[model samples]
Target: MHKELRVAAYAVCVRDGQMLLARWVARDGGKRWTLPGGGMDHGEDPYDTVVREVEEETGYTVEPVALLGVDSMRRTHPRRLGAPVGFHGLRIVYEAHVTGGELRYETDGSTDMAAWHPLDEVSSLDRVGLVDVGLALWRERPGTGRVTGIPEHPADAGN
Candidate 1:
């Protein structure tokens, strides 16, 4: 039962209006709230994996600017605490524009905290549906669109 097809890269760092999140440990341990970015190191270049995962999970320094949707589905990689999933899960989602760093909180990496989450309180916290599919692909900046993944998960996003 191995049909893995993973390809990731995410970001949606708004500003003054607030958004720039990053607070990992999802997949059950709860407390999810993403945005910074991750995965994409094969031929590398999902916009350099969102500029090196937004400076390694929120040290800032973004600038992706567009391509704001592409979420593909098919589950079975949830119990991930380490890595190496097994199934289709292509996530591209971008729309950055931070320009610099300084938010801090890269506690040795895969994220811990970084602020600016006020896009109307970001669905009342407790996120994970890739934060409303990265704010609805950054407010349907959809020069394209497609979000269909739900064999079993995602439904905590409030607001």
Candidate 2:
């Protein structure tokens, strides 16, 4: 089996009872609301990654204020033309505040749109599990930089 490791950074920007989100376009052509972040480039710092990704996806310049937590996940999936691969992902979640910039949809990117949604309505939207994880970390602010009991979203299993 093949193996791959991915490290990503995400930001939770909540303000005035709303949270900022980006619309991610999946490989299957489906879309889901997600935190404003993405995978890190080789040699990139997770902190810088979060700042850059948030701006790229949401058109908002943000300053990551706190290291919320890290979430590690593993999955197995078949490659398009090869054997099954084990994918390990380490997602760094941060609490960020918008410093500047306006809300605008991304162009020619993994995410196509950006918007702010009420925190109370987040659970009812079609979203990736990371959104919940980020929010949980933001809310609980656990000393261990981790949170538990976030259920996996069935539709997000392959993400």
Candidate 3:
């Protein structure tokens, strides 16, 4: 079986009883809300990756104040248009605060929209599992830094 590993960084930014989120547009045009962040570039620090990704996806400048937690998962999944492959994802979560810049939508990117949602209403939104995992890290502060039961892919809504 083929094997692949991906590492990404994401941020949780909450202000005034609301959280900032981005609308991730899948390759098939389906959309789901997720935290403001993405994959790390080669040789780049995960902290920098979170800052850069937040800006790229949400049009807001942010400063990651604390390392919230890290989540990892290994699973079997499809690769390209081929058969099953082993995929390991290492995701770093951070608690961030918006420093500057105006709220705007990202054009020509993985996410098309960015907006703040009330924290109380987050449960009703169509969102990726990562959002819940991030919130759990921020709220519960699990010692192991791993969040169990997140779906391998956000597109798998049943998970």
Segments of candidate 1 deviating more than 4 angstroms: 1-21, 24-30, 36-61, 70-93, 106-127, 131-143, 150-155
Pairs that collide, model 1: 4-87
Q: What overall lDDT goes with each candidate model?
A: 0.71, 0.89, 0.85
For residue 79, model 1's alpha carbon misses the true position, in angstroms, by: 29
Which stretches of model 2 miss by more than 4 angstroms? 154-159
Candidate 2 structure quality by residue, lDDT tens digits, 2-71:
9888889999999999999998888788999989998999999999999999999888999999999998
Model 3 scores a TM of 0.91
Candidates sorted on lDDT, descending: 2, 3, 1
Clashes of each: 1, 0, 0
For model 3, the superposed segments whose C-alpha errors exceed 4 Å read 149-159
Candidate 3 lDDT score at position 73: 66
lDDT of 1 by residue, 120-156 (tens): 9888887667777778767756565664442324532
Kindly report which residue pairs in candidate 2 clash with one another. Answer: none
Tens digit of per-residue lDDT, candidate 3, span 2-120: 88778999999999999999998876788989999988899999999999999998889999998889977677866678788887778899999999999989999889999999999
Q: What TM-scores do the predictions have?
A: 0.32, 0.95, 0.91
